[model samples]
Target: MNEVFDYVVIGAGSAGCVLAGRLSEDGQHQVCVLEAGGTDATPLVQCPAGLAAMSKATHLNWAMQTVPQAGLNGRCGYQPRGKVLGGSSSVNAMIYLRGQPQDYDGWAAQGNPGWAWADVKPWFLKAEHNERGADAWHGQGGPLNVADLQQPNSLSQDFVEAGVQAGFARNTDFNGGSQEGVGLYQVTQKNGERWSAAKAYLTPHWGRRNLQVRTGAQVLRIVLTTTKAGLRATGVEYVRGGVRHTVHARREVLLSAGALLSPQILMLSGIGPAAHLREVGVQPVHDLPGVGHNLHDHLDALLVADAPQLTQSFGWSATGLMHMVQGAWEWHSKRTGRLTTNFAEAGAFLKSSPEVSRPDLQLHFVVAKLIDHGRQTVWGHGFSCHVCVLRPQSRGTVRLRSADPLTLPLIDPNFLAVEDDLQRTVRGVQMARRILAQAALARHGAQELPHSACAQTPGEIAQWVRQTADTIYHPVGTCRMGHGAMDVVDSQLRVHRVLGLRVVDASIFPSIPSGNTNAPTIMVAEKAACMVLSHAEKTSVAAD
Candidate 1:
């Protein structure tokens, strides 16, 4: 017998966790959350510092690679997405940033009505439980905990000081009045442990009788039924433990599988462009041409410097190894120590040029030398700074490689496809170089690594950027929200022509934000939860 539910949410990711917790709150609706990966109960997930290792752990990370990009000298970039209960949140750097207000305003301007800064601010406030207490710009009592780092490396403070020395103001809160300065980043952590979306929303409601969470249940496709009204998503087919299970959704099916997988699921369910579906051997159910279009991400370039004299910095050495062992014990005992660090402890948002209206570039100053997203091992004490274009003109697609749901989708971010993107990135690199050269960092004996020091001229810098730049892991807009010819979902996050289905993750973002995307994604889920419940309430009234 097939199980039934009022809502079936695919992917127990950042958005899905929120949906599951909210939808089942009234204890009236049975909501089922399906996750492709297993548990997030291990120390690797709970510890904030585990992010370095998690990036390489295939069991926890999707570690998806993009198609060879012509722009980055035909190099395929690394894309690490979390596969466990919290999704990317379980394995991310945990920086809690909501981006600039104008970002959502831009979404509103692009025909997504309720996505303006004013419209979405309430959701952000509603979802946050900030450690610094409540104010006009923040909330005090909510599920997701946002707190300052318990123990940040001294180098991180030096980075912030260096930014101030480089002419940028020091901002205590990036999510506050302005996002245009440098400071220590507030993280999604509580008492030094990672406060992922799953930990915040789902874990607290684990005992809720109406909510069911299924791990290691990979959804194959949505089961759509054609009725007189339209094609409505009724259920889903999933594989678990070598057995297939069918579960019916009485009211709706919510796809929160994230930017990369949401559109993949839709296409596998035969709801993408007609021609592409046919080519992939999937029978077309809906001829939505925009299902997998408008893909873009923040392309980041790194500047590394060897800081062997800085004993506080993390690296491989007898002293560093001993510190790690001691820090682990300290974390295990009191949830405080160097192990509490998120690595990317400090960052800034700056304008690539003074003429720009808003900050168009972002920086992440890591306490350790991060080469290849921490996949490559570099033995020594050093620091790395990341500069990414806040917005790129380039766009790409997420298309089906095969009709099989298990097959990875063809991801083409087409980074640096536009010459303007490369130029902006070059400018960002120059600015970062200036910041690093500041007396604040220079006093700590920080010296530029060979790769960065070798690139001096404009031509050399641009060439170097093309040769080394890759994604900083913020991908969005594959199932973009808008009211245009290429839009996949409406302002309400409903699939353009589908019934009883919605995409409520970063995938629905009309455009990428100016900073990290996790906070914005949580806010999206908070707002989407209200929409889903409101519609259900009205439906119940009409039925009565």
Candidate 2:
């Protein structure tokens, strides 16, 4: 190794995958990527039906839990993160959504100058390569493939029609201009397998002369060096295979450790609340108070229903083992049928009212009636519809429990704090009930199993929600971007009062996007890469 490079990216997750691949494409600058997990070597990672095992397997998942929130009825929420090459993208629901245009405009209004909706749309288009081909809204020739659903179930169509019954317009594409609609969701899948960020962007670029990939490397902290000019990010100290090493960065160090761990890494590197660092016996470098604030996530409740189709999950059959095996064979050969389905095949995004402006809720329709997040297969055939309030009003925080790197951090989602947001979610459930009562769904005679006989008042439903809602497992916004005093990064995703460093991940969102955040997180990385290259060019010119 040269002991230094133009850029060094930490964590080869979603953002790091793209950043390292794109930045080193020029071949002039050396780019090294540090990944905490091993390669995407397991078959479970590629199988659409394999997530159930992966979710339970601790091998590649951080699988951390929050430290009891008062807002969530004293419950600690589950947080499953990918500890692998693609990061959570390897294990996520694979639903592709860019979120509402207004989401970006709100960031621009929050004093993040270049983050307006207009500014980010190009990057979104630039990174997508849809299977249906190119259009004004989607790109055809790009690294990631946003393709049609491999498996389409009847319940998905019923869900769409049910949305129309619930007063939502039928939208074919959520990525299109308007997000208010009901339809089947697009996914990041190719030929019945998951096309994760590592699979799409990083895999193609592997072994490039300018790129270096290091797996099983856990970063301890960034090694900062001081010069007469200012503080420079010299390198990162990390552990791989229980051995310690250091890799230098000649230009800048970019952290793509994600929403949760990015701030934890920063705090370990001495760039967080000074008091907390001192309390943990670590000397403070900078007292940036916003390193781990603004934590937000999507809280969803999975409702059970007796649907007609009982063949939803592989965990369902005993004698049908051969059937599941045959399906897998078909998928491996041609990429079709149940084997191709990503389970939660169809979904929709919409508001409870016409004047809401942005979609306030979303639906995730499961083909098979699931029981307890697929932990136990339902004895009888059934289906599920997960309801989540998108862009929740309440904000939370993430903080360190101590200074130890292995120690889990504190995550409080602070859900249902706003009475109005609770009411909105109650209305969301009511809409879901209406959909179940529709002709298309009632034809199947679906019954709500987590049966609540309580009155339909906002108070009643909200109370039930507090008692029942579980995480859809989408967490974000820990490192907020704005011009305010509490903001950690500016619009360019550059940390305030810090040079030669940047954070490109979900943590920098000023507000939570309207829906699933993985695609938007990838888009953020795309825009960040452009900004980093722009800054590098400017820095080079100034130095010359």
Q: After superposition, how far is residue 132 of candidate 1 from its true place, in Å?
A: 0.9
lDDT of 1 by residue, 256-351 (tens): 999999999999999999999999899999999999899999999999999787778999888999999999999899989999999999999999
In model 2, the clashing pairs are 369-382, 369-383
Cα displacement (angstroms), candidate 2, residue 124, comes to 0.3
Q: Kindly report which residue stretches of model 1 are placed more than 4 angstroms away from their true locations once superposed.
A: none
Predictions in order: lDDT: 0.93, 0.81
The deviation in Å at residue 10 for candidate 1 is: 0.3
The per-residue C-alpha lDDT of model 1 at residue 208 equals: 92
Per-residue lDDT value at 100 in model 2? 85
Any idea how many clashes model 2 has? 2
Residue by residue across 1-544, what tens digits does model 2's lDDT show?
4377778899989999989878988887889899998888776788766776666767788888887877778987788889999998888878899888888998889888888889888888888889988888899777888888866876688878887886778888888878877888999988778889999779888779899999989888988777786766788888888888899988889999998999988889888888878988767887888889888888886677764344443335553466678887886777676766777877777677778877789988877766545645456566777889887888888888887776878877788777666777788888777776888777776667745435367777777778777778788888899878788888888777777888999999888888888888888999989888888888889999
